[model samples]
Target: MAEGGITVTIDDAEVRAGLARVLAQLGNMAPVMEDIGRTLGNLTEDAFQASGPGWAALRPVTVARRGSAAPILQVSGGLAGSITHGGDATKAWVGASKVYAAAQQFGMPQGYAGRTRRGAPIPWGDIPPRPYLPIQDGGLLPAAQSEVLAILTRALESAVG
Candidate 1:
């Protein structure tokens, strides 16, 4: 079973064999994965820009890497604390990189009002969910998805041809 992100499986031995040959000729899968990642990165960046002000100002980062287990596609980055709305503030979260992002995107209780050790008031307050990741109808932009599919199809055709 695939443990990480997206997974592509080919059950046909012939197709798998062809793909293996093509991969061998290509020398590595990084280039293909990178191509896909770049496309997604561009779309994500565009979405962020179109979402609104705070999101528009953010920069997106896309990374594609081949791990021992599977290939990885990571798209991240944006104005970190830009989710703070009126009467809300940012906090130092000690969890996964996306914890705060999830909170901001999915929403959390509005219960943060206090001061730091230096006595500086923390504008911590309830944050409403402001989703910016999907950037479309609960998924990647249609055009972007089509482009990615075309890329994969081309790769497969090249391998089979």
Candidate 2:
């Protein structure tokens, strides 16, 4: 008892009950996160397909975090995946590493040296720009947004009601 005749004491039972409730709520979030991840993956894949062959080979991968169970959507494939979304040479990689993807997506210098199939040196002639990813506004994003919103709305309703 303190000055106001109020006493604060540790209640192990109450603490246990509160922890249980929190754990239960956390348990419910996994399925919702997984559903969201799948939906996003499908949407991204569709966008890639519509873009063109240059972007169609990429695939969407979803990974769930171990601590928070949050979902992360990523576009992945081999070397092609690096430059599909946008033209950049920063992430290009070969045996060691090189900046060639951007040259292909954008264009190489007039007389840049490149290799032939037989490893012979050849002039890197003019290469045309070919962008194939992140489909334009009238592409897959709008539909994906709607579907994702619907899924999240349902999840919220189920969780609350």
Candidate 3:
């Protein structure tokens, strides 16, 4: 599993309380965590399919290099296809397994000074952040948070019944 990724934790008081109740009743949260992971993975893929809905548009040079009308960050679909999710009872996660995933997600600033093995600049030009993990500003986006809350609510309902 990739270590560079978002760690989703519900901070909502009501959801937390409900999760606590469910946890007490179930004694194991593996199923819920797995469901959360799958949900996050699907959301991440949706972001990719939407060409990173909230992300910056691709530079003209980048589009020209791709040589086709391919979506941003999807030249060969390696990065997006590498996205996956897994977890145990304690936690869940979704992220790309590609080595350049971090660079694509966070972007490299201009004048990064990093060089490739062939002595070329890692980023010939500035690459704006194109977050595809359903996160924004160090937290889950509102829609993703709401979906997670819904998952927790369903779990709680199942536990109660």
| CA RMSD per model (angstroms) | 16.0, 21.3, 3.0
User: What tens-digit string does per-residue lDDT give for candidate 2 at 54-98?
Assistant: 432221221222232121112333323432211111111111011
lDDT of each: 0.40, 0.36, 0.76
Residue-wise C-alpha lDDT for candidate 3, range 1-161, written one tens digit per residue:
55444333435565466567778878789999898789889999998889987788777777787786567888888998899887689776788877667777888776664432354565558778888887766667788778878888888788778
lDDT for each residue of candidate 1 in 2-26, tens digit (9 for 90 to 100): 1211221214343335435546656
Q: Which ten residues in a row have the lowest lDDT in candidate 1?
A: 86-95
TM per candidate: 0.42, 0.33, 0.83
* Highest-scoring model, lDDT: 3
Order of quality (TM-score) = 3, 1, 2
Q: Stretches of candidate 2 above 4 Å error?
A: 1-27, 52-140
Off by over 4 Å in 3: 2-18, 113-120
Using lDDT as the measure, name the better of candidate 1 and candidate 3. 3
Model 2 clashing residue pairs (backbone): none
Worst 10 residues of 2 by lDDT: 87-96
